[model samples]
Target chain A: MHVTEDDLLKFALETCDDAEAQAIGEHVAACDECRERLALLRRDIAIIAGVQPEAERIPLPFRSYRPSVWRAAMRMAAVLLVGFVGGLAVSRWVCRCPVTVVPQYGASAARAIAASPQAVTPAPPVDLAATSQ
Target chain B: MVYPKGTYEVSDDWRDLDQARHGDEAAWRRLMERHLSRLVALALMMTGSPEFAQDAAQEAFVRLLKANPAPEQGTLRGYLTTIVYHLALKENRRSARQQNVENSSLEDDSPSALESMVRSEREWLVVGAIRALDDAQRTALVLRFYGEHTYEEIAALTGVPLGTVKSRLFYAVKQCREWLKEKGVFKECM
Candidate 1:
């Protein structure tokens, strides 16, 4: 039986379980070509495994992270501050009017009221003399 | 020091995560202290850079805090690793884009100067070999070996089919083996 490069490669990668691995191992030990292929595969895996970066130091507690509290507080504070400022601006816009415009309108309204006699009195008398005449 | 009730006691991580979800700052802090290191290592392995790893891990924790914590439903490590994996991938994409732009601007066609500064010959060779792997294969290898995630966990986190995950692992190991052999490391080891 002939074993292709793919079969040997797959076996070398340990994709096979105990039985297949054992078969491939037995065959490779006897076959020079398969043995060379296994050797090459082993070397590459080793290089890749070796290339992995060293285990890094565990990260300190996030609380220990500098400026964390301040940053979080600042973020919350900024949001609150914006909300507060926005509310204040809206309230101010709604409540107050320009003094000049208010008085000008007020004066005109007052003059109109004063000019209309019926506005000050309950009812103006009709011209009884003219009616009689 | 007078310890507050329930503050000094070390509870199970899932319990702590649940408590933290319910607004227990101390529980959250304790959980972070316990798991931050492993998370960082995983992030670094995934991102291939310490600074990016740090940021990614931090971002993952932040997301965890903001998320509805359901520690009972899954392992904390799985949850954290999933978050870290996504953040690391995002950072990788961002950096890759930046690198592409930089590489495009540079006139020199030789091997990158960044590639030259890895210091250790073996380390450089390994990195080069890792870079040669496809993204999925590289991710699977890093998560499986470096991050120490089980196949099931990796499959869940990566959303790849179980068989696909296994196949990727097999091929990745194979590729690594071949590369190392080419570099003569395996012969030396034998």
Candidate 2:
């Protein structure tokens, strides 16, 4: 028929239910002292609940903010990729050796040219006349 | 007693979260709508700053959106809370360090006049009580009461022994009661 402080506190916090809660409720209704204790417990709970933590301004749902930086980065990457491909293509195309054509000579001409290598000029006409004389 | 209808919608928001994770912009917006308020509230309580709380909540959702989908493991809310808590704690440390530096700079002068004297008193009592608790107890109290996490979730999140979590919660509440009594808040009740 007596509700203790612990029982009252438990009841205040709703820690008790069913049979125990019913019993506490019954005692609280009948007993003046228990009623006062219940009132105090209610007050304490109220105070605890009332400790209004500053109204938490619900933050705006983070806008799906597309940072310009990200777009810029993607752009940079694309540019780099294009530059790399372009450089590769240009390097492949530009670095070939030019083909050269060589002139062909007749076999006799080649032989005459080889034989006359050391500074051939028409021999002086006198050389044949002198030989004949 | 039958609970009110729609009071416990099966949180289909998870589907939206999954879609968002898979790159659906519309789904991402819906996901944010469903959970942003709750996340902000939790973050505000944990970090005690509106700006920081917003940043942490936003960062958490962004992380959730970007993270690989793992629908089989848990609810998106749980995952988001975990991320927010981690980020908020990180921010708390940084801010605390900054505050320490600022406080030290003003150490030789008079106490801060702008601080809310009444609220600070109440906060000091609560924080002091919390400080008196062991790490496990303090962590459980913060996660459960401040972060609004369930016991099983707290245990899972903290990776602590479940029994340890239970005991820590029990003792933390007990300590809070005793501390409030000492402060005369619960004296009349006793």
Compute the lDDT for candidate 2: 0.59
How many residue pairs of model 1 clash at the backbone? 12
What ranges in model 2 sit over 4 Å off? A1-95, A98-133, B1-11, B18-34, B44-50, B95-135, B146-152, B177-190
Off by over 4 Å in 1: A1-133, B1-46, B65-68, B96-124, B188-190
Q: lDDT of each structure?
A: 0.61, 0.59
Candidate 2 interface RMSD value:
7.2
* Model 1 Cα shift for residue B147 (angstroms): 3.3
Task: Give the worst 10-residue stretch by lDDT in candidate 2 chain B.
Answer: B1-10
Worst 10 residues of 1 chain A by lDDT: A51-60
- Model 1: how far residue A16 lies from native, Å: 3.5
